[model samples]
Target: MAVIITNRSLADGIYMMEVAWEGVVSPGQFFMVRAWETDPLLSRPISVHDYQDGVVTFLYQVVGKGTAILSGMEPKNTIQLEGPYGNGFPAVDTPLVAVGGGIGIAPLYYACRKFKEDNPKKKLRVYLGFSNEAYRVEAFDAIADEVVVDVGGIIVGQVDVKRGETFITCGPRVMMDALCQVVPEKNPVYVSLEARMACGMGACLGCSIKTAEGNKKVCKDGPVFPREVLEG
Candidate 1:
């Protein structure tokens, strides 16, 4: 269906939005967004970072040919959106702690919002680690009670807290590795990995990550997996 481009912004080089589309979108799902008339490379997948009524917001990085084409679009323009795809982060209880590195912050954005909506009394803390201090997103303070690091070098810093809070992660390998080491055990932490997806559906097998259960497609089984399922 056509999602009206109500608003758009350049998040460094990435594009963020406030789009109004018909229908209900799941809290942690994504839609394949692109100007249909100007189809460049099939479809570019972007996740629904947050939503309120018909207005669904996606925070996407305008990287590569597909995303670059999306960034140039204008308001009132019709963009094709296919989903609410893959498995989103599991909803949680207890205090919420979310961490993302670089553009991986996209899913974490929605996850945190969902957490707060479900549990109003719980405290929310976010740590957005970027490739460098320059690439670090500047808006963490708005959503999180605490914004941890905004620097270069190591994207994942040590996380210290009780063993019962919920955690979510999305970013690079080294960064996730660092986080996996630190997050408390059995705390309901989920990780979103950046892998190639030829088809958002499971047929193509482009984005697969091994889990404790079996070989799972990131496009199918995840983008978000329980921390215990990850190999570390």
Candidate 2:
């Protein structure tokens, strides 16, 4: 169990929660979070928004019963967390381009930070899209060479895919599909997918997604995958 350091609204329905944790967490990985014991039954899988010092942050949208419960909790409240699970985005030498839509921006923040840390000389560009109000768009300024934000329109259209660039994206399925269509054959694009999960481990088989290599569990094999494998 982790204690809530802070849980506050960033915007309407969007909340950022910081929990006390000292675990090793990778970008694109998530934790199965639950603030209640008996009522909700299962935990919600929330992606790592950022991790620093001894605290891990989660940027989550209050969409349903579970998240609503989470949003109501105050500081010092104890919540259950089960993981830093699944395969994370890969570190690459190529110029990095990150695309996020709405709540999808959660994981990419950490991924971009880690990328810049490892490849200091390489360039990183970020694009964020929101249907309404945008939050934390300013935070990317520190990690990105350039940051572009779009509202109420196609955010993917803003990205200029180039040769030898590595792209990482998470968002609405339609937006992700649009991105896949434009990326050149040589440039590699990786996507993070969301799915409802039960155990958060491979044992439940609740988050299986069909891929080129049969079905893969999102909670186990990935919440991240190369565009090619998903396309296959």
Best by lDDT: 2
Write one digit per residue (lDDT tens) for candidate 1, span 35-77: 7564465687787777877788777786788877667777776
User: What is the alpha-carbon lDDT of model 2 when measured against the actual structure?
Assistant: 0.93
Off by over 4 Å in 1: 36-39, 132-139
What's model 1's overall lDDT?
0.72
Q: Over all chains combined, what TM-score does candidate 1 have? A: 0.88
Q: Could you tell me which residue pairs clash in candidate 2? A: none
Candidate 2 per-residue lDDT over residues 160-205, each given as its tens digit: 9878999999999889889999889799999999999988888899
